[model samples]
Target: MPEQYDAIICGGSFGGLAAAQQIGGRVLIIDRLEIGDGETSASAVPIACLEKMDMTHVIDQVHEEIYLHTRRRTQKLTFFRFCTFNYRQFCEDLFARTGAEFVRARITSARAGRVETTAGTFEAPIVIDSAGWRTAAGKGGEKAARASRKSFGVEARQPYRGEGLHFYVGPSRGSRRFYWAFPAGDHVRAGLATYTGASDLSGDLERFCDDLHLGPPGKVHGGYFTSRLTDAVRDGMFLVGDSAGMCLPVSGEGIRPALVFGQVAGRLAERVRTGEMRLDQALSAYRAFVQSRGKGYRILDRLQSVLNVLPDPLFALFARYIATPRMLRYANRGYWNVASPDLLTADKAADPLPATAVPA
Candidate 1:
């Protein structure tokens, strides 16, 4: 007899844990490292999307705004700008509370029904992949076509106000991308992001440091960032979070999309196990669901394109206009509804913040 579980989740990071917590079953969670050393290792958030999902235990702090900037535009983003996380602690707590078995084993190979790990072999009727930045099951080749220009970023907490998130746009040395500085408690998270094959960023870092008011020779790090989705759901296996390629392409924001998809994936995984849906249906459903929530991301991409076409100063002026407090508030409420499933109804009114008008 094949040793079985209701579900075997091949990851224990935020999205994996979230899926495990939402479902009912004996879940076996597996990962290469005992700790969350993937991108989840160091995540900065002004978490506005998952507020209604009841994962409050994982949140570390919430900020007031997401300050927006570009090479040419500076705006105060008053919506969805709350950074709250203790990635490692949050992952541990999810498993501990949910009573899911976490196996510290690297997944050597994964097929329709079998998962080979460092420890032993495991088989389950249903498998969900929450692995970040990888596809062990061999369904991700289509991702190459949807790839974004590779970019890099580094985040560190600096001594600063613990209230609002700030950003620096368009001062990097080489090709003009954006740098970010979100308030991480007392310290600030300052990092730069750019397309991978575009240009070398070493020269850009020097200019970025001066532009962002960070005087430094050795105080930062950078790496690739992109939100590429793949043909994820396959066979008895379902993919959620980064493994499913749910990161935001423009901003490279992964947490909100990951959590949203986690909820969706968990529900679908349960359905597939109980015979309510087939794998193709579930994958199609998830794809449609993500496309719905992806409106803002799509819009941002278009806006970025327009911004890129204009001269840098002109683009900055546009950003300055959009960053007014009122606009940020509208953006926050709009994106909040977008990220949360329960809040999207027509009758529901999003929260209103105090209005600050944009200059004409």
Candidate 2:
């Protein structure tokens, strides 16, 4: 017989770990990597998000301003605070708090209550497909899964010190490319991303660091993330994070949404596990929650499309307009609130779990 668990979570990163937090009983989180081994994101998020995870202690630097650089001008806007953090430490700390069993195995397939992995198959009443865009849950198959991820991003760390989160826009790197340098204490996480799904960005990253005088790039890591929204619940499995295409379009922000949606799915799944709600009930509620944000996602998607086609000078002008104090306030408030802490309280609050790690 296959190993059994109350819940089986695929992909043990932000989404999986967050889902694991809300679930009680024998839970298993499977990933090909050891917890905290793979670092994919730029590793920056709104400070409030870290506070909600109670992992703020892993923060490396706090930023209160954004520095936007264009070929024609540079603008500095202050509206909200963000922080760059130690990714490994954050993951390890959050995983320790989940108290969920973890196994380092690549999930090959997932159905309603069964998941096949390289190591073995596991069954659970509750299964979450937080495995990411490449292996979305359900019977979508590999072709459809690959086609859904339309954007590719790559990032590398370099030895440098900088203030605030810096973004660059212009024709220097490509017609539709943007680069960012987020200061994380003594080193900065610098990266370039294209909306066109270009896979080779190492040379561009090297030149970007050269232009910014940040020295040679350190370790590099990144992968595909979707800007287009997809089904949140598939094959009777709850999907959160990139698997559901929850990454923000123009901003490429995935961490916040992963945590937000993961928390909701986990809480609802817990209700199902406890017999307070049926599986279909939890599925409907989660789907409804994801669909409610469709309008915002569409708006951002449109803006990203516009950015991709705008001329350099025209883009600079547009950036300046948005950086105006009034516009900045409006934009900041709307973006930050997308993954607001208020969502965490949407369900009946569960007491904090003891900080413990189920040995992997």
Candidate 3:
């Protein structure tokens, strides 16, 4: 007999765990790979989520100063607080608390209220696809999401010393993007992101390290940052994180938003399971929440286009101006919050209905 669950979630990552943590009862989390194996994400999430979730202990480093590197000079911006943590471990720990039964399943198909996996079929009234860019939970929808832009980031544990979070913004051979070096105690996450091919990024990353007089990273890691935005809900299926484009355009910060969205989706799933809301009603509610919450990300999408058009010189000048001491305070705060308000606060007004209109 197929196993039954209150909700079946795909991809046991940040967004998936977030949903599981909030959705009580018999929940199942499926993933093809072992948890956190071969994962190289040194994620930086907002301090608010970390504090609320009691995950502040996962933080490996806290950065209050930011250094923006340009062609001519390195502009220093201070007073912005960012915490870098081991995202893989964060997911693992959070998933453990939800008491969700985990299965090793490479999902073959997902429909309105059923999931077929290599291990077995799982049935639920509500299904959530919190999977990352791969969108494994969005099975039977469209093919893999097509990305107009892509990024490759690698992190290595080698000898490095940097007091603040460093971001490199300048000319690359390919599409416009910036490189970042986040110091995480023992190692620094030194990687670049661009709308270019992986091979091109690899070469560029090598040159970037050499130019900075830092040793080359060992065992460089890479993954998709975004696959463009797609529908967030349909037929009792919900997609969060990169699948729903929770990630901001230029900054690509998805952790905080993913947790917030996943929690909302999970709570709605609970309401549906308990008959507080109908399945269609739950889908509508989820769609409305995603649309309203994603407005800021949509704005960032446009800003990325503008940054792409500006010449290297112009971009450098703009960066320098933003980093000036007089503007740094405002810039520091704006940089972290360009997408939306602190989600932990902005999401308190969540009402399951009548806020957004859905197309018929």
Candidate 4:
């Protein structure tokens, strides 16, 4: 007889792994790349997640605020504590805690309770589509061009350091495009992210790096992101992380939200696996959780619109005004209240995990 796990996680990134850990039953995670090699950058995550999971060893530096830059002026946005760490190491560390099986293969097909991969076929009562915006290897597929604000980003490490993370706004190179420089681990990571349209900012990454004076750029890489939040769960398929389109509309910041959705999905997965929650019940809970935040999401959408049309000076003023310590604190706490409620009360000053996981 063929053995089946309770859940099969597609795309072993942060959300997938987080789901697996919380699934609390037999599990298998599949990915296209090896586990330890997929770390990414210009990486910044709320400090609470690191401490919540007891994974702070991955921190490269702790920041008190971020620098928001524009053509006219730079604004200092002092938000809640942010930890810039080796995302790769954090990922590798996360997988270690999951007592689940992991396979390296490309997903050829996927549906509720079943997934086919180059390596073999997997069966389970539930399937999670953490396969990301590009993999589209799972359910509730990514949107079309206009509906989805596609993103391509590339980052290079330089031997420079920043006072704090620097975010360059406006379409320096492309529409819906932006640039960033952050002190990573020990050095710096400079990168550009632009929406897909007439602009091909692939080349602009280097120019932006050069203009920012962040030193010679290293290897360039990129990926796409969906702007709108589609159905979070469908059939017996649940979407987590970028698969759920959790990134901020204009900012494209997903790390922490990925963690949020993953936690919610994982908690639901465990209930489903244990026969405590039915498929529809789980789906409804997840869907309502997502839609509950729709108002907040719309507010961000409107703000992005204003940022796109506002004059340079006004935009700078808005950026500066929002970049203050008070505003930063509000942004951090407020954004999460609706976007990432899982960590609403998570404290980062100390390591606190009522339950446990392993780390790199």
Candidate 5:
């Protein structure tokens, strides 16, 4: 019999590996790295939404306070937000648990039925295009709109200090989007998200470090991220994680969505393999599921342009004001939480951006 697989998942990163581990079928996970050297290894891995998922093994309690810093003000938030990781280690563990064939090869070209990789060609009835970048998948053009979103980050080990996580928001000359700082464990990661375009991220990263009084970044590490807002599934394949453009438009947080959809895709793939579900059924379900979670991202994309159109001073003021208690609560628990289909949909009600808040 020909070498057959129920699913061939490309890109053995978080989502790919997660899906592979969760599914019960003959699986082949293809990745460009030497098993654990891609974005998964380099990620500033932080997983939230644990109340709804089982991550006790992966998550570590964050007893420290959480801080949200605006230009002139800082606020303390609830501790429901947890920080847990071992980015590469967690992924490697997941891979080991999968019991699937692993190929340390790069997928060069892809078609509906077969995929060509640096290692060799593989013929799988279901070809999952979790390849992270654009590729042919029985479809034309990109799976989604290619937004110019990129970010750079640096992580280094140091003594453990119980300082809460800090996120800095400031406009960038390179683009309208600002920078971010995620301080987890011993290392403090600072980076800039250039939504407008890609340029010298190193300087932007340095500036981020400078602003936070974290000078002389040691063992610097940085990377880029893209935002996509469209369907991520095709004929016999589905895209998960960064491949599906699940990155948060405002934050560039991809891990949460990646894992969510990864398990969803894995479950659906099993259904497809059992002939209990058609490919379209699975693809459509994943599309609807992501579109629901992505509602906030869609709204954020709209709000970003509005923020850019405003003057810097005014923009800063708006950011500060939104940090207020009542406003922050509503924004998180109300406006943004609509990403969960179980919650209300932004499309079903009044415009989220208030008329007064929006500049004429």
Candidate 6:
């Protein structure tokens, strides 16, 4: 007989870890990587989120402003506070807090109450697919669910000191491509991304580094992130993070949404475990919660579509428009709030995981 658990969570990264933090009973988390072994994201997020997770110790640098660069002009906006963190450290620390059993194994498939892995099979009433963009554990096969609507991003870290996050756009780098440099302590993560599903970005990334006059690229890491939204609940299993296409459209921001939705899903699952609600009720609630952000996702998706085809001169004008006080406020209150209304609030903190429910 397969080992049984109160819940079986696939993928032990941001989404899985966040969900594990909230759940109670004998929770089992499965992933191919030992905790913190892989670092795929650029590792930047709003500072408030770090505080709420109580993982601020891993923050590498804090950025209070963002600079947008175009061939014709440059614009600086300081309406938000963001930070770059040590991804490995962040994951390891967060995992230590969960108090859940973890298995380093490749997940083969997961259905309503059964999760099959290379190691063995595990049984649970609740199963969450937080694996990733190419995860095979969802309702439809990974190919069907993620057929198109995927964006590729790659970045390399190099020794350079910089302040604030910077974004460059113009004919110099292909209008359809977006380039960014995020400062993390003494190093900067610089790279280029194609809105289209182009996977080869090493040459582009090298050119970007040269244009910025940064040092030789060091370690590089990146992968595809879904550019479109998908169902939150698939085949009776809850999906979060890239598995559910929670990465934002224009900015490719996944951490915030993953953390937010993971928490929500975990809490609802706990309600089911404790009989506060039924499994179907939890599924409906999660689906509704994800759909509530539909308008915001669509708006960003449209903006991404426009940016992909917008001319350099018009893009410059749009950049200028974004720098205006009114637009900056809109970005802070409207654009940012779409994922989580309280994300931008300075004083907002995530609810602490219930001690009485979590295993010791």
Best by lDDT: 2
Please provide, for model 2 over 1-360, each residue's C-alpha lDDT reduced to its tens digit, 9 standing for 90 to 100: 999999999999988888888888999999989999978888988888887666789999999998889887898878678999998998898888888999898777897999998898999999998987776343556565533647888898888888999999847335477899999999989998888788888998999999989887878889888898888888889998888899999889988898888888898899989998999999998887778777778888999888988888888888889988889878876676555544543233462111111111
Clashes of 3: 0
C-alpha lDDT values of all predictions: 0.60, 0.83, 0.69, 0.70, 0.58, 0.82
| Candidate 6 wrongly placed segments (more than 4 Å) | 138-140, 172-175, 341-360
Q: Which is the winner by lDDT between candidate 1 and candidate 2?
A: 2
TM-score of 5: 0.80
lDDT, residue 96, candidate 2: 85
lDDT of 5: 0.58
Stretches of candidate 3 off by over 4 Å are: 38-40, 78-80, 137-149, 172-174, 196-199, 324-360
Instruction: State the lDDT of candidate 5 residue by residue for 1-360, as single tens digits.
Output: 335687888878766875675566788888777566664222433334433344336553353445655556666654335464556566676777778898787677665567777788888767776655443342444433233443333343322344556656565343554555555566655555555545566666666666567775565554555565556675557777666666656556666666656766776777777787887887787676666656577777777656545566666577666667787777766433433212211121132222222211
Instruction: Summing lDDT over every window of 10 consecutive residues in candidate 1, give the lowest-scoring window.
Output: 351-360
- Candidate 4: worst-modelled 10 consecutive residues by lDDT: 351-360
3 against 5, candidate with superior lDDT: 3
lDDT of 3 by residue, 1-360 (tens): 888898998878877877777676799999887766536455876666777677777888888877888778787765447778887677777877778898887887776779888998889888888667767644455464434454555555555667778888857444765788888878777777764435346777777777767777677876777724567874458887766766666666777767777776777787887778897887887787677545555666766767756777887787777767877766455455532224432122244332222221
How many angstroms is residue 231 displaced in model 5 relative to the true structure, after the best TM-score fit? 1.3
- Candidate 4 per-residue lDDT, tens place, 84-153, comes to 8887787887887777888898887677888888887888988887877764353343333113554567
Clashes of each: 19, 0, 0, 3, 0, 0
**Model 4 CA deviation exceeding 4 Å by range:** 1-3, 135-147, 170-176, 196-199, 324-330, 341-360
- Candidates 1 and 3 compared: the better one by TM-score is 3
Which has the higher lDDT value, candidate number 2 or candidate number 5?
2
lDDT of 1 by residue, 86-171 (tens): 66665665567556777888786665678877788888776777776664453444344223444455544445555566666664
Q: Give model 5 RMSD, 1 decimal.
A: 7.3
